[model samples]
Target: MSAMTSAKELGPVRSLVPARLDRLPWTRFHWLVVVGLGVSWVLDGLEIQIVSQAGYQSTLGLSAAQVGAVGSVYLAGEVVGALFFGRITDRLGRRKLFIVTLGVYLVASGIGGLSFSLWFLLIFRFIAGMGIGGEYTAINSAIDELIPSRYRGRVDIAVNGTYWGGAAFGAAANLYLLSDHVPVDLGWRIGFFIGPVIGLIIIFLRRTIPESPRWLMTHGREEEAERTVTAIEQRAEAQGVKLTPVPESKALEVTPVVSVSYLRMAKVFFGDYPSRSFLGFSMMVTQAFLYNAIFFTYALVLQHFYGVPKAHTSYYFFPFALGNLLGPLLIGHLFDTIGRRKMILFTYGVSGVLLLGSAALFHAGLLNATTQTALWCVIFFLASAGASSAYLTVSEIFPLELRGQAISFFFAISQGAGGVVAPWLFGRLIGSGTDKTPLTWGYVIGAVIMIAGGLIAWFFGVDAERKSLEDIARPLSAVARGVPGEQSGPSEVTS
Candidate 1:
């Protein structure tokens, strides 16, 4: 359980990275990877939604379950990607695997954009889903490894936080660009193309991305780890800051083996790391259930339940997107300043309560459409703030040696379990012959899940604020939360 490595375990030093939060554009580097990843997802979302918004008549031609299958297909691919690519990256390396994932996406987007048949559409979307699955694992793990403990959550916000950015961009394309702006001939295809174009740019950025130094150190690359620490420190010092040496004690317990079998690595995830793995899985599960409910049910509430038409629904999502935008951007900062535990607990609790309020308001018809919209906006804001932090938190929990693989594992669970279920359950909820009154039940379920997620996070999730991730990755004692560990004032950060 200790993360200490022997002198012989480390590998070549690829680059020198500074470890101080203040030394470099820690936030910038943190945000860049996810923004790149999020852009692809956003464009994909927009493309998919265009199919929903524009092809509604066409979608309706299929059976209701069949309609749901289209979305499910994509989710299925994500599930596959999460499981397979997650482990692959742990073994393969971060930046390179990420580039490969992006390449996979570029191709998937192209296929989806140009698909001529319904089955083909589903197949390509599934492939794109796989790319998204891999993206979350690879990038989040990379950011988690690169960022200091202080900035883990906030920097991670760059990843989870920007998911909405993708949605917002998708929304812009859907509402402004795709809504009769592009040629009718192109319409949804234009939306799909957006991902490939943006994905190309993201792929280009991969040229400069470094592998996780922690991974280097764990693999016996102390030189790379030191380089990473140095570069980060140097950059931070250049910006007029000082760096501390990591407490020597942090790595004292890490056992060093020249190499381990991949199967052994997998066992550690389920066997030795089961507790943490469960935490990640739980985090993903909660997010999945809530998101599907929100995405799928929001439409039903407006059209089937609230009597709004499809044409007007996309525009209404504007306020929702605004809420999503502000919530994460704001929390992204708190991810560092406020710390992940408190921030997650606070938002999760507030959002759960607000969701219940929104449900009650919707049920009572307490407000006119305008009032309802305002209430919904607040709920989305709070919910997104809570949900967005999930990735940030999970990334911090994995050991550097395991960071990339850990990301692959957690994300696979998150996407496979959470992302897919949201829409599917919503369909079952709405399409189930409940006369739409049960729509309020959907909101209620979201409220309950939100509350539960917060509690789960508070109790089980490891705390990383104010400690080095190296320390946080150890057996996770209460001391990991920073009550003067074995070394007094353990942050030995110096260039």
Candidate 2:
């Protein structure tokens, strides 16, 4: 079906697309969505892990600060990319942006592998960050819209957590590549190729996944939305899954607008849903600061403090990555079952407290390399889930029409405020690797930030578990009783 050419021709549309999507049982199609779109996180993890390795400082003759600047530069790229592509993802469609963004990452990262100097590597790393940043907005938006409400929390968390799987893979690869087994210069360059090669496979897999029907219906492509949902229903039936009938009352009425101006979008974010805006900002910024500060400088800490050889840093990283990966996979279901507010609070609060305890132990001259890594494993096991939930929180709580842009805005803001600063600040704190005092204080600050984020979540977090997107936040385009200007409340529209 062709898209309606003029927004003037569009009218308030009553759609069962969201309901149909939310009611489907687990099927192979869902797995495809998980593997295909979710792999972007893995690529991001690989990039971060590889760049964080201590070998880069020696290989490129970069100072410790320069090594940390590598991460900061990349994060800056992510901020730019999220802001630039996020609006486009909402307007152009999730499928298109995801594919294009992945391609951008693949090409930029492939070129980065050949970098012979610090400036050269930083430039391509920035470009690669842009691609992955765009991927975060596009893929997260797509996953939330496509998955059933029953499984949305767990699936989104698990997918976001897959970043660690890529990190673990990078760590494992470095064990051999950064070792005496491979040439020093060749090892780091080869590491950059891993994500692109994996992405080549995933790009093909993503081709089989459909554009979001929820997005289609809200954007004046109602006929295409129907066809897309119908195809999905047929796929489920073919897999021997019994699909439930969607009641008419479950339908959402959306008045498709040509485009929501940025001015209007800003008002919706700051004016209409200020609390949710704060919630998103808190969750995103805290996680970004904590993760970026620690992960980006983890190898430096190991090499400088513990006398762990640059080649052996991955050994400790293996367990840390494993714990992060397992956190969401093991406990993500609680978000859907026990509830988002409680789970987020537990994860964030527990992790912060653990980090504080670990920092004390380190400060008192008690911990060796192995034990410090062990403590990180324990702390991040909870932190990882909380961080992943941060992504889930922002993606779901906003209106359907603004979902992509909402994620992008929060992500860009968080990265700009927290992510871009953390690595560079921590790098300076890790100055000369001689003073543990500065780095110890940095850890304390991270812990306090996370605890504060948890408190904000407890006070302001939306109880969005098992709720349809429309029910959580009515689309800006939605109207009540076919009245163009009247917005429907949750009670007025069921999904």
Q: Rate the local accuracy (lDDT) of all candidates.
A: 0.63, 0.88
Model 2: lDDT of residue 1: 25
Each candidate's number of clashing pairs is 38, 0
Candidate 2 residue 196 Cα shift, in angstroms, is: 1.2
Residues 1-495 of candidate 1: C-alpha lDDT, one tens digit per residue = 222232233312222232333234454555554555445445545545655554432422556666667777777777688667776776567777778888898898787777666677778888888887777677777766666666556656644655566666676667764455666446667777777887787777777666776666545555666776666556557767655554433333322333344675666567666666776777667866777667656766677666678677776777776777678776567756766667777888888888788778777767555566677778767667777677665666655545655666666666656666666666676774346457678779878888888887777766666566755654211122233233121221111
What TM-score, to 2 decimals, does candidate 2 have? Answer: 0.93
The C-alpha local distance difference test score for the whole of candidate 1 amounts to 0.63
Clashes of 2: 0
lDDT of 2 by residue, 272-371 (tens): 8888889999999999899988987887899888889976777788899999999999999999999999999999999999999988988888999999
Candidate 1 residues lying further than 4 Å off, grouped into runs, are: 1-51, 54-67, 176-183, 224-274, 416-422, 431-437, 475-495
lDDT of 2 at 67: 81
Which pairs of residues have clashing backbones in candidate 2?
Answer: none
